[model samples]
Target: MLSTGGVVVVLAASVVVVGSVDRGATDSGLTGAPSTTATTQTEVRRVDLAQPFAGTAAAGWQDGAAGVVVPVPTPLAGFSAEQVAGALTQVRDVLITARLDPEVLYGHDLDRLAARFSERDRADVHTNKGYRTAIAPGSTLLGVPAKVAGTMTAKAGRPGELLVDTSYAFAYAFRPPDPERVNDPLHIISVVRVRTQYGFYDDRWDATGLTALDWSSYSYSVDCAAAEAGFLAPSLGKGGKPDLDAGDAERDAFDPAAPMATESTC
Candidate 1:
């Protein structure tokens, strides 16, 4: 659990976003669908205020290290235990491989880091004029810590949906003359995270063989229930701008079949 003075709120906007590439990212980690591959066993490691990025409240994270498990739910049914295990292992391997790729991404294919997304995932990639874009090659980066400590929580979304939340505390160090100066400030982390909301989603979204109902949720720590509550900050407070920018544009001007837009039916 995040033991900072308290949990503060950080608006979802103004923060760098990534994932699925279709629905974009939500402060609560709910991106239309296809959140990611949720297979790894989650183990939460609460921080001790000594870790980097531990002071902020809205970050819903505190000091210390954490191992985060970003879960991507699948919705298919009828699977032997072996099939489920095999599928998860494959997903894990691919995630690890993503690091080796100069692009720093993960998905079903490896072409131009496009493998970071699946076919069904592409369905939701349709740009509704939401300022969508993919990560440039080598532009993606992460802190694969040797001893990553983290926090996590799960909640209800829109009645039946479940939300798994995780907060990160990252501290990267370099050996050099001015290590102390550059090291401390270089640690960039969100005081809060998107409490990802998912459901018994049994479809193409999941790379793992596990399906809805079969979907198992885990995280770095279960104690995050309170720490990350209400972490999804407000969207852009546009104050009633062109709310129908995409709707108006696509409603008449843009073709629904444009390759840039992705989608699928329930």
Candidate 2:
């Protein structure tokens, strides 16, 4: 069984076989004969793997990069319309490369994402594992595109600064080593919600603080241990049962509007 937040995904139970025998004696003429019969029963359950997110909250979400929608850019107090548009576009690209890129997610590579930042900021991005998403060594994602939904908005900061805030949810569907053997979607899907703030500055700001990035996130249906190690391990991928007694704090993992979790649920 796999559980995410309050939702539980139960796989097929073990098969059970029952046998029964009957014995009776019959009298014929002067002799008596015994007759015996045996009966057997079995039970089985079926799970459909074709539609992994059919019944989940992510069912109606946008697919892959499409969900990271950037709002229409408008002129801010100190930034022009063009600058706002450019900043919004940059933030969108960063979010995609950091969270949804297959190479980054599976191979743990961050070169491309690091290139987006300045030389001074690149090192911090590389050292910070929280900037990217990764799956365990042997685990892999299902071919299905991830479900995403969120918004990006830009606002004026200080005299020469632009601030962009992004709120989004990414739902990844992972395939078990043996797809045919697993029966629950929670076993195959994990949801990650993120809240991020990015700052873009002009020459007026200090050279060392030209750009900045900060974010917080929470995940559902993911192995707590793996998450702490900076990797995502689906409940089925880890072959572990979910903590049913765990409180409702994790339920917000799927809600983009909810406040970012300040502490680990584990």
Candidate 3:
């Protein structure tokens, strides 16, 4: 399920998940067969962004041709959408650096990167096995191309937690010895958590984690077709409004079993 958060396009994933169900009539066998319980899965839609070749032009590319731009979600009471965007950008920077530059990974750079996270997450950043390989050479990782044109609402009551639910495309380039394979552009609607911290020296937000929503649960495709068909658009809320605003009672609910939109083109 999509959780609430500042609209940050970070590389990590995690989030709060809420679920719901609707009861419907079922047929029972005349032979006294057991009746099965039916449950409705939550539907989460991803908004697609237009992708033009990066670096093909002198100045249009941000993260090379695969760089992405995700739309910032509507701001919380005290947080601006731009703030969330900035935080996500920062997180993405670390992720990209972890893969491209080993200096940051081996030196005190990670310490400073860890400083961006909450105390709990800061420790995780230093200890998590995943972070250890984040800067490994010859590793291909997730990339944020550009911000899309939509927003998701942040969950209430959990002031320290930011839930981000949005769809954006991921891109990669193949290296030598491998013939270039042109597959459909991959799109994903992610549910991520960016936790906030209040320390004596600093009070700010950091991407603690990120988790991809299961596309199969909602019957979404793990390819560009789903995005091309425009089925990935953010689900609508009450009164035909995008769920980014309050009163989004009718928006898509959370689904915990949804699988991450992972694909391999090579």
Candidate 4:
């Protein structure tokens, strides 16, 4: 659980705006998605999070150094568990580096994230828009650790193009770095989209495009339930256990096909 000190708020009710792209653009992760030959065999299934979602607030997370919880990715057929896990790790690394690593935050290290994206997404990240703004100054994430939760689904959208979609809920506190007084904790619920394909040369899956689908519901409340359930930290278990809402409110708001909101505190 994030130790309570003083309230710190950086971004509130911030909406994520995805830049527009030309369908003809070859670089877009969506544009000619990758495809692979289906080995004649049983169909592969979508993978769930590493831990069960019932009762426990935090599932599928391994404790890491400095109070960080590492998320374990579930794998699917056609894609090895390693491939699925690695892709998810890439997304997390990009966000963490862009917000925490001062050098990468402003240098080319950030551009590596666009290696798999389409031309439009690549340009957007470089042009100081959409993905760029999210990682730019005044948006540096607070020291309060982050929680990543989501699933991976792989399918053929086009004739030969394979589209693997990863939906993750990243809960974090947004407190800008400052020498002055402490700020309020601004709870952020971000849903990120990562597009990838099967690499013919490498004979494996590789990330191509990434984007922030939505950012919303900047609550003042902290998510102690997730911290306790995830890492099973003894200290977090104490005090009143506020429910870690399971449903992704911000993600659902953006998905036209998503079902009605099912409230669960996280």
User: Compared to the true structure, candidate 3 yields what TM-score?
Assistant: 0.32
Residues 120-181 of candidate 4 have per-residue lDDT tens digits of: 35654554322321333334444434444444444433433333443434343334233122
Least accurate 10 contiguous residues by lDDT in model 4? 25-34
What lDDT does the true structure give each of the candidates? 0.25, 0.63, 0.28, 0.32
Residue 2, model 4: Cα distance from true site in angstroms: 35
The local distance difference test score of model 3 is: 0.28
Clashes of each: 33, 0, 28, 25
State the lDDT of candidate 2 residue by residue for 45-106, as single tens digits.
12245667776677799899999988888998877888788788878888899889988787
- Model 2 earns a TM-score of 0.74
Model 2: how far is 125 from its true place, Å?
2.2
Across 1-266, the per-residue lDDT of candidate 1 in tens digits comes to 11112222221111222222212221122123222344353222222224432332213322222234434444324433343344444333332332233232222233533333344333332321011112222222233232223334333333322333333322221121222222211122222112121222224425422111111111111112221331111111111122233233222211112222111000
Tell how far residue 44 is off in model 1, in angstroms: 28
Q: If the candidates were sorted by their TM-score against the true structure, best first, what order would they fall in?
A: 2, 4, 3, 1
Candidate 2 residue 153 Cα shift, in angstroms, is 1.2
Q: Candidate 3 — which residues are off by over 4 angstroms? A: 1-73, 77-109, 129-161, 165-170, 177-266
Model 1 segments more than 4 A misplaced: 1-77, 94-102, 105-112, 122-147, 150-266
* Whole-model lDDT, model 2: 0.63
- lDDT of candidate 1 at residue 100, scale 0 to 100: 30
